[model samples]
Target: MTKHFTMGGTATFDFIELLGGYIVAMTGDFDGGAFARVVGEPRVQGNKTYLDMEHTFIRKDGSTIQTRDQSVLTAVEGEARLLGATTYNVVKTTGAFEGLTGQFRSWGSVDPATGQGVLRFWGSIGEASAKAA
Candidate 1:
């Protein structure tokens, strides 16, 4: 049997002058690590330009987890790489459990005609895996 989990959130990226890089802040229902920050260099492989980042997520319960993320704005023609993994505390809210850790992986590609980038992700929190649901 396959269980589905769905999380929606928005992320903002800002360039850090002193850090000489960028930081991403996220927020929303299925999102934490709003304050989580990463520092790394950006590189391009084929048509994909990505930033490899290292950051930490601190949950409302005060537990923390480290993460390494690689965000690609584009993919080479038709290819995907294992970006990274995440394991962090999940807060219990009105609808869900208060604290848990989850793992997620993401992939991205660009439209050949429009050049628009698209990203798709899959994640698991506990034994439940998340799809479009």
Candidate 2:
């Protein structure tokens, strides 16, 4: 079995138009001395836009983990906000996280007006695993 931590914090993403469509990039810091870079596609519907993002979390020493996230963007209280969820799998690692393999789920939202957001993730790591429901 693996230990589970209730994890989340703040993040930000920026979007730009590409020849094919649009790609959104992200950067954020989690609670555990980790920061991440995310890349994804942004699709606009009638009233909402959604993003499917892939994230790589890197610690200061260079250890990393990856996650895939899907989120929707909309106007909330006069500010652009994002709400989404992600299914994460440890794709690579180093240091204390070497040999780490497992999965987890994360859901969160961001307020563009403030360039900040809140996120929450849960799952098991080390010798265990899980599937999102």
The whole-model lDDT of each prediction reads 0.45, 0.54
**TM-score for each model:** 0.43, 0.53
**By TM-score, who's the top model here?**
2
lDDT of 2 by residue, 53-78 (tens): 55566655565666555655654455
Backbone clashes in model 2, listed as residue pairs: none
- Model 1 C-alpha RMSD to native: 9.5
Q: What's the TM for model 1? A: 0.43
Lowest lDDT 10-residue stretch of candidate 1: 85-94
Off by over 4 Å in 1: 1-7, 30-43, 75-102, 105-122, 127-133
Query: What is the C-alpha lDDT profile of model 1 across 15-129, one tens digit per residue?
Result: 4557544454445544554333334665766765666555554445454445556555544434543232233334332234333345555443433343233334455554344
In Å, residue 91's CA in model 1 sits off its true spot by 18
